[model samples]
Target: MHQKRPHVLGIDDGPFRKQQDGEVPIVGVVMEGATLVEGVALTSFPVDGAEATAFLADWVRGLRWMASLHAIVLGGITIAGLGVVDLRRLAGELDRPVLAVTRRETDGSDLAAALHAAGLSERMAVVERTPPAWRLERGLYVRAAGVEAAEAERLLRATLHKARLPEPLRVAHLIGAALVNGQSRGRV
Candidate 1:
């Protein structure tokens, strides 16, 4: 018997300065098992705003390939700085696994503090309710919903190429930078 390669959509926010106010572009890259790029999704939302989850949900639900997606992976839990994503809600609404993966651990307390300071205390509550990160092999920290630990590992492994992040995410980061800055730059 042979296993199938998992298809995943990886999302990442475009470049933004901490002092910037207004919307920021977000890029989503879809890949067939971390190799072939199937498609891309694009959207934007306010910086440090509280609508991250809803906006992301709408962006994903609008995808033509949403039904076939095995999972949705994010570059991080927060987009455009303090905009937080409710992992559980996203997974439930999309009926797919959702995972936020990072090269290093993003302290939950720090995220909570940012939300609280931004006066997005309501979102802070959601952040508090969300599960903490689970450390995967190779120093990747993943905060996930709608998938078991074993399945999460399988999905991540399926999408991983030679980079530290999964292919979709890696490619999405580069695309996002180019979209916003006219060319891909900085750390990907």
Candidate 2:
């Protein structure tokens, strides 16, 4: 019998802040499963703080599902965004492979430095100097072993378009942001 491939988890963080009093801080995380564009699954976590760092830190601390992941993909914004998150640090905490993607021309030296500082450079993959507008929503594709790098790469490239966020992360972003947005408004 053929075995199913493991799902690659796509991880990303975003922040939420209120302009007025009595509002709660919000951070959004989107974790997507590897599959076809329609097969991706999304889960989100929201926390306090306007800084992306806060969200990342919280997400790392609260990450209870890493043991089942094959690999992790992190957004450039999440790595470079402000707050308390250290991409390298978080990668060190996990036993899985970590890849960081960005459209910028730089080497993502900062991210690499941080990961190296945390002793996780070996597990980190940086796809830098990519063409413009590569994609808006950042995420990972969870896949099973022996799935061929070309196949995985093809799937990732096909779905991550300029407009539509990857399904898993897109749904998670919406869920997390809406959750906080509703709370800030005191809505049901």
Per-residue lDDT tens digits of candidate 1, residues 45-81? 8888777888899889999989779999998888988
TM-score of each: 0.93, 0.42
Worst 10 residues of 2 by lDDT: 126-135
List ranges where model 2 is wrong by over 4 Å.
1-5, 14-64, 77-81, 101-164, 183-188
Clash totals for all candidate models: 0, 11
User: Which structure among the candidates has the greatest lDDT?
Assistant: 1
Q: lDDT by residue for model 2 over 1-188, one digit each (tens)?
A: 11144344455443444232333332223333334332233333333223443444455446565445554455443432222233444445554434444434344467566555655554233223222223223433232222344544543444353533433444444444555555222123
User: All candidates' lDDT scores?
Assistant: 0.86, 0.40
Worst 10 residues of 1 by lDDT: 1-10
